[model samples]
Target: MAEKTLAGKTVEVTGEGYLVNKEDWSKEIAAELAKEDGIDLTEKHYEVLDYLRKEQAAGTTLTIRKVGKSGITDIKGLYQLFPGGPLKLSSKYAGIPKPASCV
Candidate 1:
């Protein structure tokens, strides 16, 4: 784990930049993370983030197909919203570990 400052608070994160402690997450931190990723975090983005966080807390592994079925957004929309790596980037901003399926 590595330490980083976010939303004016110190938090633990993995080497890949995923949050180590889910409790350390906040909307402010999400906003900062999104900014770093070049995302503006619209309501549609929040919908996916909310879904990802909830699924993560429930021990569900995240995937682009799953996210598409989430009713938050479709696969194309997700890619458009997150650009490069949708699930990975969204999970990072949502403060969850990198899903095993990511790589």
Candidate 2:
């Protein structure tokens, strides 16, 4: 399958939401995305990524409050990290087929 692009793509809302275009996912873009999601893009951001990956591995849904409780500190961080919020970020980066709750 062709790699996906996170820039203009809409985020999924279910399952493991990993980014489709892992190859196209650049550090700069990641940072920009993080900024868009309102995250500072620090080691803390990795916590969110790790959580999403883990949730995917376990086949579960990732909630924003749960993510924030996981150490995100700021709940509104989603606004910056994901323009579409938790569902979007999780689905976009988790690589899930397509989040049902993203819309």
RMSD of each: 1.0, 6.2
Distance from true position, residue 86, model 1, in Å?
0.5
Worst 10 residues of 2 by lDDT: 9-18
lDDT of 2 by residue, 1-103 (tens): 3333355654322234345544444445555555545655666555566576677668776666666676655577755555556656644544443446556
Q: What is the C-alpha lDDT of each candidate?
A: 0.89, 0.54
Model 1 RMSD in angstroms:
1.0
Q: Which residue runs does candidate 1 get wrong by more than 4 Å? A: none
TM-score of each: 0.94, 0.51
Distance from true location, Cα of 83 in model 2, Å = 3.6
Top of the candidates by TM-score: 1
